[model samples]
Target: MDAATLLARLATVIDAHDWAGLPDLLHRDFTCRLVHTGEVFDRDGWVRLNADYPGFQRMHVEGLVADGDHGALRARVIGTSETGAELEFAVASFATVRDGLLAELVEVWADVGQDAPAGTRPQLT
Candidate 1:
């Protein structure tokens, strides 16, 4: 598969929580690292992390770019935490594709901050 095709299919797998289908798209030695958390995971570990995420969530892809053997994705996730608090975050990931499959992924993510209240902005002259 081409870079774009691989990324789109990967998103599909994630949204569907289709763990079994992951191996078809991920290389045997695939690895992923979360930059903010300083954590690195192998293919199985990465799958397990998502599979075990704390609550119901949806990942929305906002943008994607692919060139040659690399791709990047920008996304937002909205979810309700186990504690019943609403949560939102943004994520960006860079991926390496080889042999028509994803060989590596490095991600950076952040909790989406709330805007100031309606009246917070200062009046301008």
Candidate 2:
């Protein structure tokens, strides 16, 4: 698959919570680096981490740009706690594709703030 197609499928799989299909879009040696935690995880480990994410409601990939074997994604994520309070996050990741699958992903993320009435979508500026 091309960069765009692979990324689009990734977005779809994430939003749909298709955990089983996620590995199909990634290389067997896939590694994800989380800048916030200064840590990296292998494919299976990464999937497990996301599965345990607290109060995750949705992940919206707002924009993706790719060329050759590299891609960048701008995304927003929203979650609701038991108290019914909503939280928003701004996420950015740079990815490297190899053999038509994601080989590496480096991500930066931040808890932007609570969501307003309009929505929890990240404000891109």
Q: Give the TM-score of candidate 1.
A: 0.87
1-125 per-residue lDDT for model 2 (tens digits): 86777887887888788888888898999999999999999999988887778888888989999998998888898988889899889889888999999999999998886557675677889
lDDT of 1 by residue, 42-105 (tens): 9899888888888746788899999978999888887897789999989898999989889999
On the 0 to 100 scale, the lDDT of residue 24 in model 1 is 84
In candidate 2, where is summed lDDT lowest over 10 consecutive residues?
113-122
**How many collisions between residues are there in candidate 2?**
0
TM-score of each: 0.87, 0.85
* CA lDDT of each prediction against the hidden true structure: 0.87, 0.87
Model 1 gets an lDDT of 0.87
Q: Judge candidate 2 at residue 87 and give its lDDT.
A: 86
